[model samples]
Target: MITDIRLRSQQLVNPAFNDPKELVAWMGALQGQEYSMAKWAVGLRLKKPDIRKVEAALEKGEILRTHVLRPTWHLVVAEDIRWMLKLSVRRVKLAYDSYWKNHGISEELHIKSLDVIVRALEGNRYLTRQEIGEELSRAGVIVGDDLVGYFLGRAEVDSIICNGVDKGNKRTYALLDERVPPMKELHKEEALAKLAIKYFRSHSPASLQDFIWWSGLSITEAKQAVGLIDAELIKERIGETDWLIHHSCARNVRAKRVIHLLPSYDEYLISYKDRSMALAPEYYRKAFNTFGIFYPVILHNGKIVGNWNKSAKQKQFGVESSFFIPGIEVDEGELDKAKERFRVFNKGGND
Candidate 1:
């Protein structure tokens, strides 16, 4: 049986971290290139209120720009990205750089490909991989999709290239000089320490497994972080597993009957390896259903009781929700009752 408090901690302490300053530092950009891990961290939620706060945080330098951790874009803190990449690079090598080498991507070719992309984008402001490849082939590189796309992606990581206008079709590349520089640099160890502190601060009352899920960092990095952190924090051991809570923040942690319409990869839903606290075992399959991998869900009183979507029909607007856990199970009445909320929430959408 999942306790409401446990689930709240899992999703972040009920009235969750209302300060966007606290949460946005963990992720990177709004639009990421591949690296779903980075994309997932700064997920796109369905609610305007939720998005507004995240965007506000982006405007602040609390989140910095560094291609340190994931190969692709991550909206990590200005300080965290520098050290995060250094700490996690070896793991990245084991995962990608090494694997890419096996696939014929020598260090020389990697450098050459970036040159190819930069030469292509030198004069032209926006160009696709196909366009970039044409120039690369002319310059004597293979210019295949593997070469072109991967090279362009890495160029973004190198902080020389980034996404630009769609050109009425699909993605194109632009110089980072053209795109606004979103963040600054921080010392490596300072970044790591700060990242750990941010993780524990924003998402309090969490275990090491939770940090592993949230930052996508290895156990070594996670434990090192847990060791270096210094703050008013409390630990609660539920048997062999223990969770760290921000003593300063969680002091007045009050439980509220919340209906957080979290987005697909909302931090609360995705930032944990073992999610038993917020989601039951049986409902796991239902959450990550086979319907092409849908976004996770909204929790009524901490347990994910249903899922919701936005829609419009006949010029009238409405939000639809399917309750997973029966309402009678949680309450004596209608479980996960969202129909009335949707009706009220969607009225302004039509007019």
Candidate 2:
């Protein structure tokens, strides 16, 4: 008796899906959560929720702690980032090396950049983007305007950036050695296998292509990894592909009416390629950024029906911002549920 793995993953983990921090913390790198306390929930494509809830989460220590993966300012859990980075550092290096080569940065210069960043940022408390750029400029090198950003990204990929202290719209980096508490080392192979298993266990019913995208691995490596775990996983044909999932997933998928107003750079959209299950291709450009980044989306019946974001006065906390209905007919159930979720997100004021 086969069943749906997506429902199973949710049940095994977030049955109610209430604690976003828990799932996000495990994945290691969710971009919007990286830089801002709260990203514009661009999932539905409209900017919603200013800055009230984000502050509240931070105050509650429920969100906005230190962590890194994907070599970016990912706002993942403090506890999970260590393991997530352990799993993804090699991939980050691959991205860094490829991007560096494309940019024509010499290996020697790369080493020098690392040295300069190490010295400049070490022991420094917090720094703004402009400050980082200035420091790089003083090191007798010109990376133009995006100098600091590119190099800092490089550092992050190299497992050097450990912390991103928020300073208004800007962020400062901390040495990985300083910010993150020590963790046991993981073998490269172990990390690869563990992450592959984790993603499958959490987000099942996915193809190899989906795994490749989520893991940031080349198609070849993705295939190899899948081969390693294929025997242990259960596969079922959905459309043209055999989606892999754990045995326990997808047991009871009774059209659970869930309206989730997720943040920008949330995992659901980015987790798979065949998103038609939740969204239509025509709305891709509409619901996502110019870069194919999915915006904050409204999910009804386990699918994206619209997009949204919020405007914050000081951009300090998350809020229960108002909603605007489109010309299309809206489901009363989904609509009310969305409003209730938004109210939960915004607690009447900032922290």
Candidate 3:
């Protein structure tokens, strides 16, 4: 029942969004470190999944990929980025403090690097990481691959720069102000409430701990956030656990036989600290590795049934599946439909 609610909440079943931008805004943010797979993650949630449409949203600046929520890359809507960053930047920086110190990125150096980066990207020019690193070197700032990555990430969290249109397959950075128009800024309290509402509205039947994990808020702050939105959410106790479901999602969602080829780090599994609702404990190791890497998964009726991999051969795209339970009964019609949906999302060729 929880999984059914999650399926509807996550838009994996009975998807209600027609536009990719609307969908991203609805989900708050999607894990997007894996560029290609993250596109499919958005596509799979559409009423009509279209990879081109998702990419268009990113290119047109309707949605932006940046470091937020946690220290990892997430795709957030352009309008929400400012307030979201303001709410989470300090926590994100705290998480990365040690790395910065170890890399000799003192406050002065951080300021200097941001200044150089802002100058380099001020004129609507998009620079790849290599190009940005070269600019830093030209400015007499010591630069390396790792240091460049840190500098760019720092710039992103500071709202100094953001993702620009890709150069072929390479990612580029653009001035955040240039890429996105000015938007209203929310105060800290308003931002926290908004974030809590967004997370629960899109990921309901989640616990306070799940919210804390996904939002990167400390336990005290996370609890305060939930309290700010307590009246709007419905608490349901399942066994010994208390789960919070948004009022809008507090209804029975009929379960159906649906197959989903969820990408690695999809919110369905990753957003929550405990994944037992969708992933069985016995199969945890198979779905995730020791290093916190989640593999692409096959979900049948809201439960992870197997794992899958994508392949391309001479422009032809294919999906290979490995079932956890051999000889498991599956509806061939549904499975074929799921694979066909993926093929269409892949544009019938390797991307």
Candidate 4:
């Protein structure tokens, strides 16, 4: 079970990267539904984790956030964006079909919007969502509040626009081609194989169902992709359930009684259809809710024993937790270390 924890969360051998881009590249994509938490998700995997540095990487175009895989924001490396889109764009488009229909986002509108957005963001300029909406309206496309977001989200999924540097505190969009250098696109088979391998390597001891849920690939496609990477993956039968893990993952490491302040929508929790391995069924409601909200979790030795929240203002950080597994003794020192980690992340420094 402990081996399950280390490998599934990419902690095998405990390697740490200095660059957020490298981490995103290796992990394939980090869920970006909660943007700030997504930054910390990548930060926690790096040696010197800091929110500001991850934001710097985003500004430098080392990594890009866009609507990719599963019709949500995912932080993907610039070099892989083209091939990733080639792999998942059709699926994402299909997922949004109903919204497109209800909002009258016809093919013509998509095409026209693309042209308008391209012209508006030409010369490597960035534009906020509101600015883009106004530009669309000026072009005779009345994008109401709801449609405005749908338009931008559709545009992003279509690979026309991507995250630009933050203008003040508001996020801006840039032409994907301008922000990301072109990379040779991979053939569908090769792309599927590569994505499967990356996912298995980073988030293994997971089932094909988990891959389907995380990648938004159909079960048939998931099986095909997994088949392509069979040589690199090892299968284990834990109880009645079968799991796939990377061949190189260490299986001998003992799970220490450690604590981790996993951020909201952490990949450790979100990258699977089944979370029973990491979360106890009895405490599920406290950490996860019906509204698709995943709160910050308190992980004690790879299992979610509770949920935690932090309040940070200026340089001060305060953390509070509610434990589900009552009477479980967590050393006070361990709690302090967890609080300090959150402090460093919140303060954006060791201080």
Candidate 5:
């Protein structure tokens, strides 16, 4: 039942937005550690999925890829990045501090490195991590490959820089102030309420614990956030658990047989802390590996029935599916249509 609601809430059943930027804004932030696959994550939720359109939005800074929500990369719209950073950066900094300390990067050195990075990108120039590291090295700061990412992530959470257009296959960073236009800022409580609403609205039937994990907030803070918007949420007792769904989210939608080829790290699976509603414990290993990798999953009527992968040979592209359950009933015609949609999304470009 929750998964059925999620199909509509996540825009997978009836995708409402044609523009990727608006869609990213609606979902709050999408996990984007896997760059190209993450674009497919966005494409999977569009009314008219287009990989090139997502790339264009990223290139134009309509949406940004940076370290936020946790210590990983997430795609957030330009309008919400400032407030979202302010809301989550403290926890993220705490998560990253150990890496800085172990690498002998002191507060003073970190500040100096950020200054060098800012100066290097001052003239509207987007520089790759290696180029930024070279700038730091030229300025007499010793920055190695292992420590470069931590330093750049530091700048990103500090609101100094964000993702720029990619150079071929390499990623670059630009000054945040330049890339994002100024917008009205929300205070701490307002931002928290806004984020909580967005999470519950798009990812409903989740628990307070789920919010705590996704927002990276302490239990006390998480409770306070839920309290702030308690009136706007619906509390339901399902089995042994108490679930929270946004009051505005559609409920009790009739279930139908549907098949979706969800990309790895898509929000539908990653946004919640407890995945039992969709991912069965028996087949967990089949969809997720020991290395913390979530593979592309096959969703059939609100449950993960199988997993899928992409393959490329010369100029041709294809998808391979593996059903975990033996002799599971799947419409070949629907599966073919799903694969064709993915192939069309990848038609003009490699990504």
Candidate 6:
């Protein structure tokens, strides 16, 4: 229980640091599969909650969202994107090989598609996914319905492109080099050590297995990486489980009495291989569905005690929640405070 408290505190929700780019860099990569919610994930860590601040950072090219770990979209800073892609994209590419092969996407076609995309997105231009697909079609490259997303994902995995600003409701793509300033690449071992340090420091009280699961690195490779950073880390035994945390992380912590409305797919829940510490095992099915859809959760003092959802009606915000902690009296004031945080976040602070 003390371990869980310290781990949540390490998430830096108070945002003693404010820059979204710095926050993203510190965490290595934030799970960004759900674009809008991902923005809120970044927002939740800020001293003043505002989702638009994250969006503004995206527009200014301070950060780049691309396919990094696990072949899913992640919000990563410009400086770290290259080395991070170099470290993890190979495993992702190998995993996606069968999907690409099934769609008749050949090496020649992939190269041709990249060339077309590069030419189309040159000169600081940002093209929508549909626009990029249209450009490929005009070039005699067949990007079928299913092939469109796979092809674009390949461009990101290959580090040729990344998500840019939004075009109305649609997302646009930009040449990564044009958006992000040039950064020196790191050697493989150095890169591994850096990544290990970042992950543990930002998401501490984690295990080697958790790092492997989050990074898509093999157990051997993960072990080697963590070994490189051993001097900077502290190991602890919580029950029978051995956890690795940064030496600087909080110890001698007590369970927090605060409540947090954590977004779906937030790194706190998704970054670990085992969630039994933050989420009770029996209630996992209640918070998440069998199809892997994680609803927004009401986190009370580091434990996921319930799931919550919100809606907007005529500019009025409403938050609905269900707590799993039995016989606990409902504190409307506390619930309202949690709701206000989300209210400000969702409204982008206009409220």
In angstroms, give how far residue 18 of model 4 lies from its true place.
2.0
The lDDT of each candidate is 0.55, 0.58, 0.89, 0.81, 0.88, 0.81
- What's the best-to-worst order under lDDT? 3, 5, 4, 6, 2, 1
- Candidate 5 clashing pairs? none
Q: For residues 1-351, what per-residue lDDT tens digits would candidate 5 score against the true structure?
A: 898888887888888898999999989899998998889888888887788899999999998999998788899999999999998889889888976676667899888888999999997899999999899899999878877888899899999999998999999999999898888999888988988988998888899988988888888878988999999999999998799999878898855777889988888887888888988888888877778788899988888899888865565678989899878899999988888888878763353
Per-residue alpha-carbon lDDT of model 1 for 1-351, expressed as tens digits? 224444443433333344444445422222132223222234222232243344445444444333445443455544444345556655554555655666778879878878767777775477866788888888888666875766765665555765554454455676655454545666655666767776675566678887776666778877877777755467777767787875544344456655644445455655566767777888876666655253636667767776766554656655566768765344423333343333433342232
User: Model 3 — which ten-residue stretch has the worst lDDT?
Assistant: 342-351
List runs of model 4 lying over 4 Å from the truth. 2-9, 312-315
Model 3, range 1-351, lDDT digits (tens) per residue?
A: 899899999999889998999999999999997999899899999998888898889999899999997999999999999999998899887877766776667888889999999999988999999999999999999889988999899888888899999998999999999999999888888888999999999998999999999999989889889999999999989987899999988477676778989999899999999889898888998889889888999899888889888764666678888889656788878887888899898782233
> What's the TM-score of every candidate structure?
0.70, 0.75, 0.96, 0.94, 0.96, 0.94
Cα lDDT, model 2, residue 50: 27
> Model 2 over residues 1-351: C-alpha lDDT tens digits?
112345335332235333445544444345555344234331121223324544444333344443243444455555555566656667776666776676778868778877877887778455666776777779887777665666777676566764455666555666766665666766666566666776776667777877887767767767776777776688778567787875545544554445666666666666676776656777676567676655666655565667655546565434342223345455766666565555543543222
Q: Candidate 6 deviates by what RMSD?
A: 1.8
Off by over 4 Å in 3: 348-351
Q: Between candidates 1 and 2, which one is better according to lDDT? A: 2
CA displacement after TM-score superposition, residue 4 of candidate 6 (Å): 4.2
What's the residue-level lDDT of 257 in candidate 6?
Answer: 62
lDDT of 1: 0.55
Expressed as tens digits, the lDDT of each residue in 144-207 for candidate 6 is 7567777788888888888887898899998888888789989989999988988888888888
TM value for model 3: 0.96
Mark the 10 consecutive residues where model 5 has the least summed lDDT: 342-351
